[model samples]
Target: MGQIDGWEINCDMGEGFGRWKMGPDEELMKHVDVANVACGFHAGDPSTMVRTVRLAKQHGIRVGAHPGMPDLLGFGRRRMAIAPEDMYAAVLYQVGALSGILAAEGMPLNHVKPHGELYFFVQRDAAIRDAVLRAVRTFNVPIYGLPTPQMVADCERVGVELIPEFYTDIDYDSRGALVPVAESVPVSPQMIRDRILMIAITGQARSATGTTVDIPLGMGGFSICIHSDLPGALENAKAARAAVNEVKKGIRISIY
Candidate 1:
């Protein structure tokens, strides 16, 4: 796909295991363009994955594989010290599994986005970033994450598309890294909408410390991510989608 002139709304979906569920996925799917389906490592089971894909298909939303470290107990948010080789295999394992399921449903894997700790880890570690980028390249699809310089360099080296992402449900520090969820204050839907508009219009994010952090919206435009695990997720997704669409209408932005 070419660079989107407009923005894309992507929500982290299918993050539940077994009978227990998280987020208002059905409602959120109606508003987002892409669904980052969890691939059995962090929180999704086989049934959840299949169901989420089907739901996305029913809503005409694209599906992406959301791979994460094998930290189910920590919900894949806790950082771990795994070897690069192990990280590579783990990523490939998850992406392949999700692709197979999508194939069965006659759907193509649109992209890959690392979940939680794995996403942040790749930002600072060159070895792991290379390993993860290599695995994503094997799938021949775009990878989504924060646009750190190291990640951009690794993507260029591996010849894969890297989609920049901004989180509407979390806080960021001056360095553009996400503030630990435990320490961040709650954000309302209006606040989330404001943040989305800031990135789409100004290409900057207001950090928690009230510092203006630079946010590069790459040539592929950018994606706004809303965590489905947050309270009132449905309202947040609606607010974010509204903000992106309104901006596109005014500026003639085209969404991919």
Candidate 2:
């Protein structure tokens, strides 16, 4: 869609298990600018990781590492009570694994985005947040994070390039953390479009509780995240891509 109307499409891919597949990554690769390939912890195996990286390269899509807690059963959606040091080591281990795959394929990791529970943990825990930043800095790559005040400050403090992220398929609390899908958070295409436009136009989202909350929108540089686990994810992605393009053309949403 970037080619269509000057916007980029990004997707979370490579979330498959030993013999269980997840997304139509091979087909979806044709339509995105970036692919956040899962790194074994959450959902992916060695073979799946290599295949995803290779496919991403073949399609000329920017490849990124998507690391999460080691929870195959919960798919990393369940929070783990891990120590900060352990979280740091887990991140480093997963990132290293994915980096090895990318290196072997001659494609470097472009960014790192923690998945599921790890994402939520970092939103509130300073120690875990610092550990994640430290791990990312060790790899010297950009990090994708929710657009929260602490997240921004943490990224800056650690000297890691931060990409403030928005979600098209998930709803957020007044605090900016994603409301768990299990909680039956309802999100619609129009709602998502309106939220994006509001951020583009005013840099805020009216929370479910009707409170206006800041949405960083990168102050001008932001990347939207679309989770493949959502129902009708492909269609939602298409709608989001089109909506962003429309807003950019109609209102000139700046990304600087």
Candidate 3:
């Protein structure tokens, strides 16, 4: 299946582990269309997952799985050597748990988006890509990821719909590779707004060196992501929401 048309912002949710918290998800939910919720492997506990799913339901947002490597202390940001089978099993387990919670809430699993290091691993490791693709086949949902050449071809071959995710709050290098979020510094709210507007209108993002890099954000069925862990994430979402509205009204939107 193809992605839903028009621009959308999918934000990471359910990151808090037990009593520890992360991000302003409650207020931020009002500004996004989909919530990429954390499964147990990364940062969420069972209670956190249930609470996050309920919050998304209240906002009328689509619920998707954000499974990560089993690295809670590291927040799943550390890239480690993992077997393809291990990757597949971790994904299945995490997605299954989230799906169960969604089922209990009378909601559907909207999609699956691998979180943290695993998300970028699809670009680096062929095995990881195949493992993720296999899980998508099992779940029968769209996958959110970067529109790298190999990933695009693999998704086409495997017959899984991939939502090319353009990250509004993350930094990209000159060659358009993502800068690790751990190294990210606080950015001004205006810069964040400008990036969204520019990308929404032109399908290009500014590189760290101030050059325009073409992104594969198509006319429709594409998604822009806002990481909730970013400083002023609520403000970032507000900026994204405004820009998306402007883009929608700027032209005749062709929705799927």
Top lDDT model: 1
The ten-residue window of minimal lDDT in model 2 covers 1-10
Provide TM-scores for the models. Answer: 0.94, 0.88, 0.94
Residue ranges of candidate 2 with Cα displaced over 4 Å: 1-7, 184-186, 210-212, 251-256
**lDDT of residue 219 for candidate 3:** 53
Model 1, residue pairs in steric clash: 6-254
Residues 107-134 of candidate 3 have per-residue lDDT tens digits of 9998999999999887899988998889
The sequence of per-residue lDDT tens digits that candidate 1 reaches over residues 1-256 is 3133348888999999999999999888889999999999998989999999999999988999999989889999898999999999999999999999999999999899999888878887899999999999999998998777777877988998888888888898997788766667788888877887787667778898999898776666777888899787898999898888778778644221
Q: Score candidate 2 by lDDT.
A: 0.79
lDDT of each: 0.86, 0.79, 0.86
Candidate 3 residues lying further than 4 Å off, grouped into runs, are 1-3, 251-256
Instruction: State residue 211's C-alpha deviation in candidate 3, in Å.
Output: 1.2
What's the C-alpha lDDT at position 30 in model 3? 93
TM-score (C-alpha) between model 1 and the true structure: 0.94
